[model samples]
Target: MTNKNRNYKPKIGVIGLKGFPAFGGSARAGENMMFYLKDEFHFVVFNTNTHTSRKTGTYNGIEQIVYPKFFIGALNTFYYYLRSTLHCLWDGSFDVIHVFHVDAAFIIPLLRLRYRVVSGHRARPQFAAKWSWLVRQYFRFMEWLFFKMPADVITSVSRPVAELFQTRTKRKILFIPNGIVFDEKSEILQIEEKDYVLFASGRIIASKGVHLMLEALVKIGYTGRVLIIGNRSHSPEYAKELDEISKSLNIRFIDLIKDKQLLMAYLKNAGLFVFPSYHEGMSNMLLEAASARVPLICSDIPENKQVFNDDETFFFETGNSTDLAKKIEQVLSNRPLAVEVAQKAYERLKREYNWKILAEQYSKIYWRLIETKKPLNSGDSEIQGNDEYKAG
Candidate 1:
């Protein structure tokens, strides 16, 4: 299994969602990883979205496999998972299979019996819960499927996620934080050194807690205008309510902007980056802000804490507007401390969370799994199969 002895370039298959220069952070990570490894390894990227379009053409020199056209939500997700798995199995060309997300991870074992090296990316639990009976059961089932899949390695987006998986499955988990291949930084600087602040990005939905950021702004009496970017297409009603709330509260809202350079231009002088996500495996926006060297105020979650020290990063209770505002105020008023925190946070992000480090870590794991082909097992699969047969 030594690299020098091997004649053929090891074929690597990455099964994930659509990638850049499209949307989302994870997609960009997959894109970058594929581009970087293309010369060294035979790379194939299977996208649930692209497949629906029926385009099998190469993008950036990497082979692309797009799945069938399907409807949105659960149906689309499951379709991609099944399509990617079955395609990899029948093609019988790949030496390794890397499936992203838990839903697809469930199919790893069945595919693993064919492909020797299987790796799955577990971003976050579908339902972030520890108490709900039904939700817990569902997660347990997914977890079981993942462990039983015979994947030699499980990749987590954050250290906390890796730790959580290790606790549940006792399998070695590798941390590969999402990567961002940001376009060239904008030359323009928009924000003047004012009291203005910037909060949240990506889809303007409740889970993102954009409203929480607005409430925080109100609570802190941040008279300066606050800019909120990213669409609310996922929850139009909620977006309408948020707009009404902003108007009633006298909070100014900047219309959503999708351009990365334009977004970076805004980040240039923004006093702070506020991430009010209630739950995250690891947030790409937060990492991007850190990479852009902005002071951060995020939810006081384990993953957030991993990114910054308690002092450097101000965290309010998840979904708590008042606390988020307090944290924002503390950072805004204390200019000297804010700069110190921003510097430290950026340094930490560059040292540990940057794409280069993440890519290297993933490369090590993917290669190692190829070297030692070992599949992990789980108890949930046994229980589920037995329950199904009994029901039948």
Candidate 2:
């Protein structure tokens, strides 16, 4: 964003999402975009030092503006969002301020007059059980504000979210699902076929339904190993509870997997990958599993259904542990069916979920906004209500 060279590329400031060297769906999405779009745009990502302090520097060829972590939960998110938005506004170097999540969308009205803002609606955080009633209400208000606020562009990571935004705002929305950067040369873990491991990755929270997966495994009397990878610090109480539960079941929980090669190996070699999340904007883990060619099973949520449409064999009733157990058993016992599903998922990932294609779509959107707004010299009045973008 700060580059002023005559040969300068478009500068994009990404806010309200974790930066490089972080975990979770939002972080992964941000990282993937940065990886693919690094050459086309100069990215400046704002990283909140809520968990640990990271110095401001270039991470993976993109600028990282580190800010000290604040309070926990929605408060922390709002604080970071406000600070990041203010930083971008004051810097005046960012041509496009791309914001992620609905909470961050609260700053859209303030920035629309100055910078060309792209609001990415990742998920409906209002429904997360972790937040209190008041917090949820505040989030709902912010979501409402997001729809009402004028922005250069609006994008969603899943079809359901894109449709919801289109239905609510009556404006075109970009439907760009999260993608996986498949590692072709990573050493696959030599997990024995007889191990019959079950894999799941995400924040260890109730919304993710890791507890449900555990219950399902127990119900099915699955004696195989279960590997759950994600940040436990997200929900310490839930993680502790899961730890206690794991003591009685054949499950192992890895709090954080920093090694990409090892993580890929686990994903590539897992007997089955199960995603029992209750909600999601778009599950990066599901895409990763599919890319890794893991036989998949997930809860029958609209989000998951959007990705695996009519593939009812891989979905179980949401929140039903018994049904999930049955699906797990079916996948494990029916080797031919598992192979078929895994191969189909791999083909789909290669065809649709590659980051290279997704990045090009995003590049086009950014360029169009840049050209349409010409923010360098355009006045506020000239930019407002210029929503000429249609669905992509």
Candidate 3:
């Protein structure tokens, strides 16, 4: 994109998150939204080298504003948050300012005075065990600003998170779920099926509940090969504990990867895919596993349930190692039933969680904010799409 190519499209400045073309999580969410809506909007995404490590430049057609992210305890993230907000304040080219994460709390009020602001509420970072007590307390205030700030639109990837905000604030919260890009050319690799059990995440963290899977493996005396793939070095102590627990088990550790196609290949080969995450904002990994059509099991948390019911995918009690072990055994022993369940989930992902449909829903919200500058209260209005994800 050059000025002539701009063609009078809406210039939206996106802040918060590491970068576009991201491996997964919120950054990936931003990438999918921009890619799907590229023709209708012009996006200027601010990124941090701490995650992408890509040079500051254009990714395909999108312009990336890159910076280094520091790790000063929990406050380390503040480096990116503070800098990006300040930069957005200075940049006058945007028609709409879309901010992700509650950390942008301090700037939303000011941004609202200048331009239309859309708050992306994805997760509650305060609940994660990695954050210090002080940081958690600060996040609570940040979350408050996220709800209280005068933003034009508030969209949540998780239906439960949206409902929680509505319950507390009595405001209209839009529930726009996360989605995975379907690769039409994707073909299963020549890997054997039911060969091993798998658990993967962006990084090894306590909130992801990897220990639940390990303890379940030991409890069941599972001797099958287990594959634990993620960024182990991100949390050295947790990685050490995972290694210790797997001493008696057959385990293979692979470095965390950003390649979605490669991940789906790994997912397809697994005999059983265990997603024991305790919390999520409509996990992209879970969606990918469903899209992979692999035998799967996930924790019975509200976030996972909103995506798939009991019949769509196997579920174990959250944090219950014994239940996870039992579910794992059930999925492994009855492969035919597991396959049927997996197929159902794949269908659901296509019908409800497809990125094209969800992104179009986002486009609806954006145009309403841009053309009319009117409030789209999802509570009483029909602005929200796909009623399947409506809170029960």
TM-score of each model, paired residue for residue: 0.82, 0.87, 0.92
| lDDT over C-alpha atoms for residue 357 of model 2 | 66
Better of 2 and 3 by lDDT: 3
Query: Which number leads on TM-score?
Result: 3
Which residue runs does candidate 3 get wrong by more than 4 Å?
1-7, 69-76, 186-194, 377-382, 388-392
Candidate number that wins on lDDT, 1 or 2:
2
- Residue 105, candidate 3: C-alpha displacement in angstroms: 1.8
Error of 1 at 162 (Å): 2.4
lDDT of 2 at 240: 78
Q: Which ten residues in a row have the lowest lDDT in candidate 2?
A: 382-391
Q: Give me candidate 3's TM-score against the actual structure.
A: 0.92
Maximum-lDDT candidate: 3
Query: What C-alpha lDDT, on a 0 to 100 scale, does residue 48 get in candidate 1?
Result: 58
